[model samples]
Target: MTSSLSLTKKLVNVAMGRESADMVIRDGVWVSVQSGEFIPNTDIAIVDGHIAYVGGDASHTIAQDTKIIDAGGKYLVPGLLDGHMHVESGMVTVTEFVRTVAKRGTTGIFIDPHEIANVFGLKGVKLMVDEAAGQPIHVWVQMPSCVPSAPGFETPGAEITPDDVAEAMTWPGIIGLGEVMDFPGVFNAGEKMMAEIAAARDAGKVIGGHYPNLNLGTIFHGYVAAGIEDDHEGTRVEDAIARVRQGMKAMLRYGSGWLDVEGQVDAILKHKLDSRRFILCTDDSHAGTLTQDGHMDRVLRHAIDAGLPPLTALQMMTINTAEHFGLTREMGMIAPGRWADVLLVEDLNDFHPETVIAKGQVIAQKGKITIDLPSVDYPVWARDSVKLGHPLKAEDFALKTEATVGTPSAPLRAQASVTANVIGVIENQAPTKHLKLEVAVEDGEVSLPLAGGKEGGADIAKLALVERHKATGDVTVGLVSGFGFSEKCGIASTVAHDSHHMLVTGTSEEDMAIAANKLAEVGGGQVVVKDGKVIGLVELEIAGLMSTEEASIVAQKATTVLGGFKACGCTLSNPNMQLSLLALVVIPELRISDMGLVDVINFELIPVIETGK
Candidate 1:
């Protein structure tokens, strides 16, 4: 199962009748992604985890010991591959994610452990790699290149240095460098970023890219020149065309909150770019999406609904992704001498797999995994990562006025109205808006205009980013609008993107403090509080990013959290996803970091108070 040459010899022996075939799939209409046609009456013979023959008939290789499966003339397509994704984002362990998605017509995935890397560094990544290696399905790992994501912007729980990248290049499961989140470093040729890229290049691994809300001209070309290959940050048709035009594979993602596929698929339907250059991925899907609707299967169906041909979408999820990572010879199509990774679906357009085979073994049927997963245990050091330097109190989240702009003679700071910069949240998107609102300065403190703000009015809650890594007890506070809340409620999480700090938003400072301290007391996880009472909590004991709980259990807990959000009078499809990205300094508009408010576009720290300078 490791080497192609080893499996090829066994396949040849089976075809020559020197060895008995282990499995044979009979009478299947081959969904030939290789030829772009469905060839009828295709029979596949497999032996020792490799396909021996794929033709009209395979009676020659059949033996008394061979296990036979009658496909009933169904379309046999290649197993789906999630080109780019993060297992930790599912809020479940690696095993839990595979167990949930395998039955949904997805048999392979390429995972980046950057979320864990930001929490526990190399040791955390090794835990995920080891777990992925033991899964029944095909799981590949990518070395997280940017642990802090953007240096000088925020402090992460851990740091991945060049030496770490070089060592990871030699690991058994490392695929390539994970998405280069440090776009500033790549464009400016930072030494650390360049050394990490050089290590991946020397190891002959593919490099992944992350370019969110970027200009699509020379800067994009500069990033391509730095050896980055593919990107999944595209959310529009023009974004798709931009990446393909630059000779980089454009990864159109359809995660839980990210709805980029519908808008970007027009590049192929209307713009008519080479379909080969487009790929489908789920960069960050949550557990509820996988357990309820589907995984890559859902992505494919949505693509077709958006006017992409069924076969074309399948190609993007299968062969295009496989070829991009140099894994075409191993798993892309249902061809001779390749791994027996096939999905028998009743219909091509609907894409519901009745059976799934991984490495010549039937692992899932319908929507349930039949095989057992690996028994991997995380070390004790991986847990208890939420180190709050001191006990957080309600007063810590208060935003006090420093100096106000008023008359030169009667300069009383408390009497002036200060215009404060706020982080504005967008529904179903990653980027936020920088809003300027004038607030009354009372008792030398900038207080929120909570009386006039309601569900439809211009009211905002206080947002706080608590430093949980160094126990420095640095709490940076800012105002953020967009979570339309009419009640006293708050939510907190350690799953903050890239830097993985503790982000809390609340209408009441007391409720926000309660949620934050509750999560800190549980080591690390997510918590929701309504009217100063705990409503929902999910304990992600592993690095504060992932839970060892079963996928269904975590989904149930998450559902309760969503209910709490609704009860608090805030109604967004995926408010947690929007809340989690508030600390992601890489995205555009404005974000909160440990250093203070960050203007992501300018890549500098701006004062929360406008000062009108």
Candidate 2:
């Protein structure tokens, strides 16, 4: 490593004003992502965190200690880059996130810390930026433009104004403004929202866009004319074509549940649009997907399967993304004066990165990370986030109604929309169903609250959102179905996305209360309880969202938690996914936010109604 650092000195001696290199890889095929072509029998040289040579053999100009890596007929491609993502979505710290993704040959990421920003404000974005700068790979963070995501529609812990964007642009790793999630505000010409976009422009930084609607008339054109550069909200071919035609790079993502690549790849396959205007990203993926599947590597495979050529897939992840972010000169190729980031893959179609290097350092070899990273410390404020106003009781969730005064026996009934708008769980899609279900009323409410099984008991369950941000002492109560939680068990998590609110779901209110208190006792984390006994707990003290713990340690704890859910008969793909989306108010069909039950399609708060009256 010391010799590699000194390599830059040797390169400067060779050519002060010219592009040269210190370390070079001989006998390799370069997957040129810029032109969607592969240059065979090529050599790439690197110096000073930039590529200095990309031609034939460079064995003649080697220094005494200049390290040489023989690609040995393998394909050399620029390291992968994710166009849009959230670091906290992995439930791992930024350092851990980098360490985990390095093994998959991910050299760059465009992250939006908006999830954390909505909970902790500027301090959260700063924390992410600091950690990003320290990483061996590139971690470019975007200043969160929208705090509550939707202003006045919802309330966030802190607000980020136009001034926040200007101030954050001065930060070292602040690449640009984050995804402009407030499309409503932007289309409506809200002064505060437009001013933030202006600030980003004044700073000469890129602006990320998030327009999730399918309407392609005036609103879409209005969004592009407002100075947004790239968008990852394209879920259809037309959506991708429209963005690219309007001079916006269309990002195709395939995360844990969001499968968008297959549809948007049509822009290249069918429409024959400029492939240079497309990029690939995993918008939100968990640790399991990162460890087991891959990071950008997974997106690449899916893109290839979606009918895009191998070279086009590589371009979308590397050169295309780098060009969009204005980092092409520094990265995106094995050419001269670029970062020494390369992936050695035996097969181009599968594109499995066997050896990975960043800044002339071997970070991963054969799908294994070789870097050693230490854990960061969590402050007292971050550790202590869960706070309930008061101990929750069974009656706290009681539904009151007008009862008849003189009836000998009365049916416990109240008026309610029998069929509910259920948030349909699609395996690999972000769009949800506007499902409705009608059921029998119980205790004057439409709750299918179930208790411990085997005996003829109750069929009621409980869902609660504990106030953890400010110790506000609020627990917004609601009902949730389809978890398949049997027996008296409760699942709790502080890693709730977007708001970082405390979400606990259980069959018995007693176990739910116990689990919530346990999470509070540990400052902040995830917990699973059954019959009043602690089943699993993963301590995430940093911002009540992530633990500065080692990825392996956190993953191990999370595995145990999943096992706990299985013990209670919970069987969903990543059962925690269901828990996380419960509080997300952006994606529609149906959802529950901190404000109340939300009809996400209409963006309105709906009341949790009682049974038939």
Cα lDDT tens digits for candidate 2, 88-205: 8777889999988888889999899987787778987887888788788988998999887766555566788888888998888998999887787787788887999999998889
- Number of the top candidate by TM-score? 1
**TM agreement with the true structure for every prediction:** 0.97, 0.90
Q: Write the per-residue lDDT of candidate 1 for residues 403-485, one digit (tens) a residue.
A: 54655454555566778888999998888998987766677776664533453335688889999988999899988888877
Relative to the true structure, candidate 2 reaches a TM of 0.90
Measured by lDDT, the strongest candidate is 1
Q: Give per-residue lDDT, candidate 1, residue 329.
A: 87
Number of backbone clashes in candidate 2 = 18
Model 1 lDDT, residue 560, Cα:
85
> Which run of 10 residues does model 1 get worst, by summed lDDT?
449-458
In candidate 2 the C-alpha lDDT for residue 523 amounts to: 68
